[model samples]
Target: MLTLQIYLNRITTQHNGATLDYRGQFSNSRLIVADFTQFVNDIQAALKSAAEKNIYTPPSKLFGNLRATPICLDVREQLADGLSPVEYKVLLETLMAVCNSRAVKPEQVLYHGKIPFQAA
Candidate 1:
């Protein structure tokens, strides 16, 4: 099984758009994304694409900070094996809800769930 946990720490709204500071645990690997200005829109687009294509790859921008690292590959591999397109859509929807909600506290866990590995 693979597990995911995401937390939002702060949001800065600028004249152009909002930027988010967040962190996440993809199974056992931890990562932080700072000043992610297009998080909401990007995730929504990803959700749409995944629905149409029946596959999901975490947005490249979402892990920009970890580019070229083994962790990025690990996350992609785990997600591919552990979740189906339908399951990934659900996860993206949960992420969208968390990003849209004002009631969330800083650093509060936005999502935490297990996804059983999909059989080949």
Candidate 2:
């Protein structure tokens, strides 16, 4: 399986008119079903869609604590395959652990299992 790691930095304005900062990272690991390049394109497309649609609702608890612009994101992913059973198991466990992690919201974690290729 391959993995994608995304790092983001967000600057938000607090209700009291102060500035709040957030820096964090997340990952999505899955088996490579298509060529590596294609897979990357698909992921980027999904992330872009999510961002454009404003699908990621910053946790309501943080309302009034952030601004809408100046959000920066960096992404990277593992491009190789052939993981040992132990490694794969650890990956799956990690995926599960973050599946519902408070640190990362479900919408913020963008993923689509299938990569669309050009029509044959």
| Candidate 2: Cα lDDT at 81 | 43
Q: Which run of 10 residues does model 2 get worst, by summed lDDT?
A: 110-119
* Candidate 1 ranges beyond 4 A from true positions: 1-31, 55-120
Candidate 1 residue pairs that clash: none
lDDT of 1 by residue, 1-120 (tens): 112223332222111232322232222222223223344444344344433443333325566323311110011232323444443444444454524433322222222233334323
User: What does candidate 2's lDDT look like per residue over 2-112, in tens digits?
Assistant: 123332222122223333333322223444222333433444444344445453332234543243222222222343543334433333333333232323222232222
State the TM-score for model 1: 0.24
Candidate 2 wrongly placed segments (more than 4 Å): 1-32, 57-120
How much lDDT does candidate 1 score? 0.31
